[model samples]
Target: MVDVKKTSTTSQNVLRAHYKTLRPPNALRGNEVIILRHAETIAEVFPDWIERCKLDTTQLYPFDLNMPVRIPQRPNMKEAYMHDPPLSEVGRIMTQIFARELVVRNAIPRQIYSSPSLASIQTALDIKNFIGNQCGAICVDESLSSNRHDSKYWLTEKDMTRLRYCIGEFCVELQTEKSSLNDIVQDMKNLVATLVQKKKQHYVVLIVTDSLAAQILYDALSGIQSSYNEPLQQLYRKAERTFPPVSSTVFTPSTRNGILVMEPSRNSLRPLTRIGETTRPDFDSEEYVDAKP
Candidate 1:
């Protein structure tokens, strides 16, 4: 368990404190699979504290981190957080530092995939900026989305538009229903294949997703899915009070021959499957299409 009490509750500590999780010994490397939980959102679903779930512009994030806490107000034009809430003010800064750390580690991802949520996309974009254009439009995958199964709680139309605009083209959001663990494995495979097609120099793929979603991939890679769901430890690994708050899991054999790859790590690993409907938003309506890149 990470000791959140030792340091100030500021968001920067969230990143710096987690340093123990990524020491060079087991730190990220080329041709590895990085399953990361998205940064903090304006309203967090799985807040450190359970009471934050209230609509007090504070509690909403604990239950549905992607959704913000809201109160009754006069009907007016919505802000970015109204649809699919983006990262909080602190989350944005934390993510920038996280991206820089990845670069410092020489673990810059060749391709970045994200859950179809503003928070996840926001994290992916920051890494994209630090790593360069090799990351084309952030691959938005439904399979990598939050465990909140209801579309009503998912990204809004405006959220999708922002996503489309962020990617610089029509974005194809894969739709899914109750995806099993293997579903994510398949997505990893797709990413692996794409990474393989690229030059060997390009390695490390980042999947910016929810804590629950990231755990699914981590368990699949580490072969610990059924071991025990250790609370929220999926994304935040703890140490003997000496380690900082930790985040990140690198899949073994995530690469073979200097390219990304995935295979069964345990006997329980399931076969991959192709699931979900494809929804492509028109880029013509994108207001930023005409803007310089």
Candidate 2:
């Protein structure tokens, strides 16, 4: 088992500090969706897996349950892992930490939806077990999996440089026409609508997916419509480079709610307020800390 204590203490401290300030967007009291990328995967981040890959590049990467392996790139160090990898020990620890934090803050979701990938499913299950009754059922949804989308290939250092340049160029295009909503985006929107339209008015739904799907959902819910607008040839050119590692993004209905993007080291929730709008004073200032209910 990967020792959670070995992980950076800075991240844990940051989570502890900011967790005191997290609040359910008043506008989304009953309806809100939080999208998160799955924790690290065994095939991708485990030191043991890395050593194994180094020892036998020709052999198939092993899986806990003989899961598939999808290599999109040149089978580079980063992309050479099982297709449906399970969470690494570090990932399991992180999930437990996050779940415990949510429970302490009284911010546990009522419903959890995970991508079909083994890593996501494992993360969701860990969280469900940790939070107990504070969280509800876990559903696996294909729409949230990156497998449904085109492959994103990452190559050597030179290729990564080119990919970054492409992402910079694409960000500029975002200022113009919004990219047409694709089938995946539509499916995600439909899922959110279905959740929100339920008889219960207050529902907090958590979606655990790949970085690409998480980005798309963030763009959709925040009304940014920037990142996912490009065509396949242009979009996903550098999907991995777009977002920071292990980030959690929250989306609520009201403009006043703004968008909260949290990462492991960031001490405060970064708010992206809508144009010409200001967030509530309580939310705007971190000075006021509310007692956990």
Candidate 3:
């Protein structure tokens, strides 16, 4: 059996120490944001989909994570819109285990929000149910979903390759005249700021979202700027190996005084700062992107 108290205490101490030097300049230092990735999907369903489409996963490199093997040519708006997949058996079990840990620590969130995507919704519901909290509403927001921009469902191999490098760059390259990259970035920042404000009044805010949104939000909160000129492969490789699947990132407000950030680290929700400081890159000058090409 895991010692929930000891583990939570140790994790909290580690985070408090680490963030002392690395906290972002403008972050909401005292508030806490928990970003959780949805659990693994049912492998059988995806494999069946791939077989039906005659897609090849072998073409992808081992390091190329999160690239869809196949995309629907004519994706149904309802089906393709963050198509909700039920969690795998393993995903259910993982959530239960983590939920138990949260219960033991009395860390059940005051409120829970999830991406409109089916998998994310299920993950949030499972956690709320296991924690036995009926008072807190588990609301679904489309903004949290990856389809927030109403972008297409699938991407070409070249696009996927580019995404593997830097998601920010992918956003820049894939931006349509209808949706500017600046707008997307600002929207994300706004969402984050709104959540932080909510956390100020409430105890903790839990956001269950997709990997791409999770990564982008994490980078934003940490104030790690991505360069348009950096080799996409280099950035992709670094993030792929450094982070774990089903991992959690905690964002705490920056503070000068040493007030310990007390949060339980259950399951994959460990301190991400241990990975190292995310460097700030210049994004303002269009010259950065032009210089690389």
Candidate 4:
């Protein structure tokens, strides 16, 4: 997302070449990890080859279902009108696509779980209908409930806007260890302990919750503790409540069964290789192109 241009064309070429030969990061190489989006949908974002390489078909699950699929503000919105406030028409379609994508590609998991939220529940049911009910799909809302502070108050559209502002401030502040990172950290720990304990060697668990809650929980699983390595609860006690949209990231633990990591495309995530702070090679350098002309 950050497009910091190279200082020179030569540097740009070198960077491109570097990528050509470089690999991807696999922090969770062998096993699966806690998902922090609408839940299992995070896996929907990654290509199937990545899952195959990691051999982690069974150990995938989301925390909850996706609700309010189309925020009126979203661009190119599909499934705009539906009885359910959550899960737009496009959402249902995309979710089905998500399921078919997995099934056609042989990425179906042995089990599925979701939060009790209206959206999460609907998403799970939709997925269940696609693959049949025997895939072990169910709703687990307790672990994926709204934030504690959020529970204390009602949310209005204006409140949602302010909450976004607060979340941005919180993200920046967390990076700096400034004032309100503790609660965020604790919430994360609770989410991780729950998701991790449920994992079998090949188990995939999806615990869908609100977006900000998901991010906080996922961050916790990555072992990102605060300045004192203190629990997130301590931090939460000091900060105000806020909600943010979910950002997606995939994490695979070590895989002992199926393909754990693959490089289908050059842009794909390859196995771990350390080539820090290196520049790419120039394509036009005598080695590439028809210099005869």
Candidate 5:
């Protein structure tokens, strides 16, 4: 299992620093975007989930007269191991703590963007529930989901790695317009641009996503340090992915007047793919398959 990261001092410092910006005494406040990593998942918290997953799925489903109705007999064990697993009991409590931190800091967001992964959405939802954000304020962004090109970035498979059910879906995968590291940066740029344009100044927005994706967002928008020598993606790959559950970084877009325009030429970006799409892969076909070892 990938090590779960604890909340960092730096993020806490940013939260401390950001509290002042939210209530500035001057003109209308600038856009404050808080990029948050999702909380711990069932797979991350429960060792027994994998043990239950190892049972033959077909035989397990047929209910017996002696079998208790709860726990392992439930349909979602395979589904939980197969698809995006929801939060565990511990994970739910962690989210509550995270939500309360936001309230205490006065960092309530006007709008929210979330990755489509079940865990990411659940994390976003818990925060919204705490602060009373309407459904309309939250959106599931395809760009914010796992990077379409990289199998490593895909969700749900992490807990099931080397397990049987995990292998099939990824065995033949189709890559998409979100093709490279540059595309990751571009997608986040577009996200920031859209929110900055749509919402009024001082509107706070929250983004809930995976940690590596959050790292990309942070490195792209927060500016790389002066001392780092490697290329951005190289540097990115080397950085540790672990971060506290629901860890966040607060940023205001680097702006000229009020908005920050970070658009690359339309030609540079992939033809826009709609949300909730699942395209098939023809492994035999000689399409643009990114088959890297």
Candidate 6:
């Protein structure tokens, strides 16, 4: 039998490791606004805690990370995969749960803009449901998805072997594409500028994207100024992104508004199914399109 104490210790370690980006010594000020990825069902373990706080769901923005990526390897399949796939049922539920948590936390926004993707649109719908339909929501730019690419590479067997050999290196490359990373940072700057210009304090934006995009944004939020720096570098003294159990450390700003850090309750190591794997029906396949739910 597993030792309960050992397991608990391990779980805490895992949580700490996975969400290292939340580690503090942050530069947050009270009046400055904050933004985060969309709320997810994974945070349901502390349902009571969520109930206490309410989000400003009205101004919530769902930034889609699912922009098309061009992996330039095969002439036979020249086009890149559809990066902005629809949300899986699990993703949808998680999103709704996240929305509820935000509403409870009183972190909703007054104006919102999302990536022009169906999944983001759906998330916008949920936020509207939570905070009422009076808030502003729109898909302002396709670039918000950070979908910029003109080249590609195929992970052949040899490359896969090399990736396995040095998972950290490959994972870094996979996460840190120069073009896409820059685009995302620019998008974030735009969003922040809009908030500041509008003088909209006490508002929050929720961005939704793949883990890679999330990690990238999380790094930026933690004050990473350049994409050239390795993500795994600061995490572990001797670890890299390819290391099997990569976790981020997050630090909250020292604002009177109070900052909370939460994650999925379960410590299961199962792989998150890509949106295409579920009922979304090849949403990533790029072969067809849904009628826009």
lDDT of 1: 0.50
lDDT measured at residue 107 in model 1 versus the true structure, 0 to 100: 66
Model 3 C-alpha lDDT per residue in residues 164-260, reported as the tens digit of each score? 4111122223233334334545556677767655544636567777665665566666555744234544543343333333456665543327533
Per-residue alpha-carbon lDDT of model 5 for 109-173, expressed as tens digits? 66677775667766776777766643225665657754454333334344334322212222222
Question: Order the candidates by lDDT, highest first — what do you get?
Answer: 2, 5, 1, 3, 4, 6
What is every candidate's alpha-carbon RMSD to the true fold? 17.1, 16.5, 14.5, 19.4, 17.1, 20.1
Cα lDDT over the full model 2: 0.52
Each candidate: what lDDT?
0.50, 0.52, 0.50, 0.38, 0.51, 0.36
- TM-score of each candidate? 0.52, 0.54, 0.53, 0.42, 0.54, 0.40
Worst 10 residues of 1 by lDDT: 237-246
Q: What is candidate 5's TM-score against the reference?
A: 0.54
Q: How many backbone clashes does candidate 1 have?
A: 15
Q: How big is the positional error of residue 55 in model 1, measured in Å on the Cα after superposition?
A: 11
Give the worst 10-residue stretch by lDDT in candidate 4. Answer: 165-174
Q: Model 2 reaches what TM-score against the true structure? A: 0.54
Q: State the lDDT at 218 in candidate 6.
A: 43
Looking at model 2, residue 241 earns an lDDT score of 40
Better of 4 and 5 by lDDT: 5
| Model 4 C-alpha lDDT per residue in residues 128-245, reported as the tens digit of each score | 6787743444534334543433222222234435434111111101112222445544544655555554554564444445554554553454443324344555433221122111
- Candidate rank order under TM-score: 5, 2, 3, 1, 4, 6
**Cα-lDDT of candidate 4:** 0.38
Which ranges of candidate 1 are over 4 A from the true structure? 1-29, 45-84, 134-136, 156-164, 168-175, 179-202, 225-246, 252-293
The TM-score of candidate 1 is: 0.52
